[model samples]
Target: MSHITETLNQRGNRYGEFNRHAEITQNIKKAMQDSPNWATLKPWHREGLEMIAHKIGRILNGDPNYDDSWHDIAGYAQLVEQIVRPPAPPVPPAVPMQNPMRGAL
Candidate 1:
């Protein structure tokens, strides 16, 4: 076999995992949909979405940067975190005031 053919076969072996990238993208979308609010997505949320798109594009184009063994979906995780609410602030609850006229009734 030609050296070129050998290299191509090895490279093609990694393409099988391309679908995983698509799966990650789908999960990201689902997370976004499940979010209660869309108006207040943080900057990192947008960045993660853009990064996911870039990663998918890179994988589809056979970019050499993609790792075949490691399915790193940090972008998806970050986006989901943004979709979820931040931790609530700790504060004392306010008690409702009872109407004074109720005693007279």
Candidate 2:
């Protein structure tokens, strides 16, 4: 088979695996929505959780060893944290920038 054809076939298979158990993903998200705190979450929080849930579901249905899904989960959670959590206070510079020549004769 041609290289392009082989690549396309591999992609198609991955898509197949992802969609083969579509209900599983939806069920996971549905259960999450049932949580009492779900309503209280900010929109971004809900989105992040849902995305994480999706990656989780995919991992469950597909390769358990897949590293990308884990990274994706962390990325989504980080994005949610950025939006929902308060920003950390800025740290003071250890040494403030100054003109060396300012005090020089």
Cα-based lDDT for every prediction: 0.61, 0.80
For model 1, residues 1-105, the per-residue Cα lDDT tens digits are 999988766755654344665676666666765778644777767666656654554465455466732244564765568577687789889999999899695
- Name the best candidate (by lDDT): 2
Q: What's every prediction's RMSD, in angstroms?
A: 12.8, 5.1
List, residue by residue over 23-61, the lDDT tens digit for candidate 2: 778999999999999999888988898898888777777
User: Residue pairs in steric clash, candidate 1?
Assistant: none
lDDT of 2: 0.80
Model 1 poorest ten-residue lDDT run: 68-77
Backbone clashes under 3 angstroms, per model: 0, 0
